[model samples]
Target: MINVKVMAVLDLVSILQKREIAFSVEDGTTIRGLLEIMCSQYGPELEKKIYVDKDKELLNLNLYLNGRHIHFLGGLDAVLRNEDTVLLIPYASGG
Candidate 1:
């Protein structure tokens, strides 16, 4: 198993129930796999908040791995490692 540290912004604290959490994934799990596990653990409400589709074709929030944006790191196929830090930042819209 690989242990990852997940950090969420204040806007997502209510949904996640905590600002930071330690999550365990199977060895060699990719970002997409990790997201699937999280969605299953957190339920439909959280899933809807994160993904625009079940296939993960679109994302409603920004995901960072160790302070680097996932978009530049091979999207969801990025492999995770033990002790890696993941951050979730909710979308913000302003006038």
Candidate 2:
């Protein structure tokens, strides 16, 4: 099994802040699978609040696995290994 650490940002993490969140999966789980699991764990109510589009892509978040931006490599298909910390960083723009 593959073990992954997921860290959320903004309101996503706010809901799960009560406990340490991480999970074990099959050896080849992609970022897409990780996100679906997050939505399930948080449920529809919280999921509605955290994202605008919960389907193929994330709206408010910039994903990083082990400090490397997933988008730069292969987006949701990015391969992950055990002990990788997945960070969900929310987008912010200010002038």
Candidate No. with top lDDT: 1
Compared with the true structure, the alpha-carbon lDDT of candidate 1 equals: 0.88
For candidate 2, the per-residue lDDT at 31 reads 82
**Model 2 alpha-carbon miss at residue 82, Å:** 1.0
lDDT of 1 by residue, 1-95 (tens): 98998898856788889999899889899888887887888888788888888876799899999999999989888999999998988897677
Candidate-wise lDDT, in order: 0.88, 0.75
Instruction: Single out the weakest 10-residue window by summed lDDT for candidate 2.
Output: 50-59
TM-score between model 2 and native = 0.79
Clashing pairs in 2: none
Considering summed lDDT, which 10 consecutive residues are worst modelled in model 1? Answer: 7-16
lDDT of 2 by residue, 1-95 (tens): 98888877666667777334778978888887777787788787556654676564555567788888987869888877898888877776687
